[model samples]
Target: MSSAGEAPSELTGAFIEIAKVTDLGATGESETVVGNTTADVSISKDQTNSETNKHSQRRSVRTKTYNTLDIEVPALLVPGASQLETMGVVDSDGEEIYGDVWDACRIHIYDKEPATASSPAQTFEFENVEWDWSEISLPEDYGEISFTGWVHGAWRRGKTATS
Candidate 1:
């Protein structure tokens, strides 16, 4: 188990991947395969805190607001590429075209260097996920694209690696 003042194992060589819920067969069952194409991945859970003060006493409560997932991958040039295409965008006629906008998907993060045995991986199931925004940067070395989305409803299952 984890406790305060202990630093968990760092996710140095972790990876992230996403798959459309519809990709699953009629039974809606599939295995999570982490993508190696993505260069970076970030996941965060945000909450709204409300504090009540009553006559020199203070009370506070926290409510889960939403979760956000950001993925950065190399811009694909091939037609109907795998990673970018699955993210609701496809290369059409030498132009980027939007594909299915509203689709449910699952995002998986696998921590290769877990702090403990229990912190192996985490999965977040998002419903009604749509493309929020993306950015392309032209640097001296190479070009990269980042995609961000707002998860309507998210369910997370995992355990933090403990010391």
Candidate 2:
């Protein structure tokens, strides 16, 4: 019998596509994130020029649902990296300001370079995202769209070469 290992296929993996860093404007103000998918949207018009413009839109998305069990996995993280820290909105005195997500919410992370102990560093931006998932799986069981966090460990290794 053959060994119990499945051969690798090029189709199975998660990769980062859009990478950029940007400020969330001034505190208290809101920003919008448009993705490659479109289910809902906002429209703005320039009356002076009589032109229609797309304001805020919920484009296409691949949403995932998770419950308490998934959270316990520990390795599963939104946006997929453990290095991402959560920063909440604070007031002028640095007091925490709580906000509500009436609809879906936008997500943001600070820009940082990918680094290893002795490897060369590469600069990259965190993703600022907006998404909704009321249609994916269950309603109350849905979770945040995992951005680019689920990186696999064996990614750097390849099949051994033979003559």
Candidate 3:
């Protein structure tokens, strides 16, 4: 309703966003965190570009803030899977990390079971699984993403004492 004569229309669609991982450990080629219906992975690699001289170039890593960036992830109707809601920056110690240029990439998967599980619970089921990675947007600050307040409870069991 409006003062004079106006009408508001309803919108339908899921909300998604991309966040830059501000911090992460300086070492390790890849890291993955599995959830009930989603899995987030981050890959680190050395980067060299003409814009930045070889010595001046810095190391960069690809990290997913959330396993499922899809708001309607569950609506996808995949069985034996849940929806991923949030994602945070990776924990980096501010060291020289490297990966293949352009070719190398990190992928987020929505597996049926959690990756931390000893083994896949069942042989196979109608677990809805989908994956996609948003582009990385680095910030001006420098620091490895610490798991200080990061949420790791996307699974039934809770975050491990040490990530």
User: Considering every candidate listed, which one attains the maximal lDDT?
Assistant: 1
* Candidate 2: residue 106 lDDT (0-100): 27
**Backbone atom clashes (below 3 Å) for every candidate:** 0, 10, 21
TM-score of 2: 0.17
lDDT (tens digit, per residue) of candidate 3 on 30-59: 323222222122221222333323555585
- Better structure of 1 and 3 per lDDT: 1
lDDT of 2: 0.22
TM-score to true structure, per model: 0.47, 0.17, 0.16
In order, candidate lDDTs are: 0.42, 0.22, 0.23
RMSD of each: 8.5, 19.5, 20.6
Q: Model 2, range 37-111, lDDT digits (tens) per residue? A: 111112111112233335564554333332110000111123311212221222345443342111212212212
Tell me the tens digit of each residue's lDDT in model 1 across 79-98: 22454445445553334554
lDDT, candidate 1, at 82: 50
Q: Candidate 2: worst 10 consecutive residues by lDDT?
A: 67-76
